[model samples]
Target: MNWIILVIAGLFEVAFTSCLGKAKTTTGNEAYWWYAAFALTCGTSMFLLIKSTETLPLGTAYAVWTGIGAVGTVLMGIFFFHDPATFWRMFFIATLIMSIVGLKLVSAH
Candidate 1:
């Protein structure tokens, strides 16, 4: 299903962005490989997004995809990268998630 593919694509977006963060923290050959992985992962993510767009509304698809990516990235930063996880930050993330859900519920499949 297109929705399934879209969700996978969003997960890929998270993967690539996390790879980017890891790449920045490395050096030399390791960094180069991480960068390469990031590029490949991002490319795959975009390809899936394009495929999903064939059946889903463009605006809804893009917003949900980006929302998933944003939430995943923030969580990864807090859990893996030891980034700050303030109350306001968590609150906004929850709000973003709710919005994403609301969008999905309102969208005509």
Candidate 2:
């Protein structure tokens, strides 16, 4: 059950961050909606994630949340918004993945 909440929190984290990025691109009424979605999703997700990480390992939960957010944002930038496909940037993302994995391993020990 906590895992389920954590997953929802992760999704909300992605959605909110993505919406915030989109909000920057949007203008007028749509921008307002995007901003609201971003705020709401982030706020709600953070609350749930805090509750979740209490039961889960702190390092494990945080690493997962941040990993999801970072990866999701970059993927959105590339596939959805046509950001440049730079090898260096992708390579750094791989670094982030490795760091997250390392964090999880450390926490398990």
Candidate 3:
């Protein structure tokens, strides 16, 4: 159940980031609404992430949460926002994933 919460929090992280991307693009009243949505998602997801850390080790939780969020954000932007994921970008992202996996393993012990 705790892990479930963590996953949900991570999903929210993605939501907030996507909203942030959108918020940065528009201007006037529309941007205000996007900013509001971004803030709400960020606040709510952060609270859930804190709750998640209650059961998981802090280091492990933080590392996984942030790593997953970063990678997921980039991948999502590529797919949804049409950001370029060239060969170099893919290589770097892959490296990040591997390093994060190592961090998780270390933190598990």
Candidate 4:
């Protein structure tokens, strides 16, 4: 369904962002490879987002998509990029999750 597609798109957004992080840590050919992955994932994410918008409300879809990407990228940062996982950061992430769920529940589709 469109929701699934939207979720995939969001994940791809995460992937692209992660690729950027990876690219930052590398050099020469490896950095180029990561950048290539970034481009591919970014394009795929956009395409899926456009497809999902056909059936999903643009506001809801965009919010959910960015929400997923934000949460996912933060987690990726904590796990992979050594980002600080402070208490306040986790609390806000949880709140963001709640907000995303709230949007889904209130949505008509």
Residue-wise C-alpha lDDT for candidate 1, range 50-83, written one tens digit per residue: 9999989999999999999999999999999999
lDDT of 2: 0.82
Off by over 4 Å in 2: 102-109
Compose the digit string of candidate 2's lDDT tens values, residues 1-109: 6666876787888899889889999899999999999989999899989988877887678778878678777888899889887999999989987886676566533
Residue-wise lDDT of candidate 3 within 1-109, one digit each (tens)? 6666776787788889999999888999999999899999899889989998887887777777787788889999999899999999999899988977786567543
Question: How many pairs of residues collide in each model?
Answer: 0, 0, 0, 0
lDDT of all the models against the reference?
0.96, 0.82, 0.84, 0.97
Clashing pairs in 1: none
Runs of candidate 4 with Cα error greater than 4 angstroms are none
Stretches of model 3 off by over 4 angstroms after superposition: 98-109
What tens-digit string does per-residue lDDT give for candidate 4 at 2-64? 999999999999999999999999999999999999999999999999999999999999999
Poorest stretch of ten by lDDT in candidate 1? 100-109
With candidate 4 superimposed using the best TM-score fit, by how many Å does residue 59's alpha carbon deviate from the native? 0.7
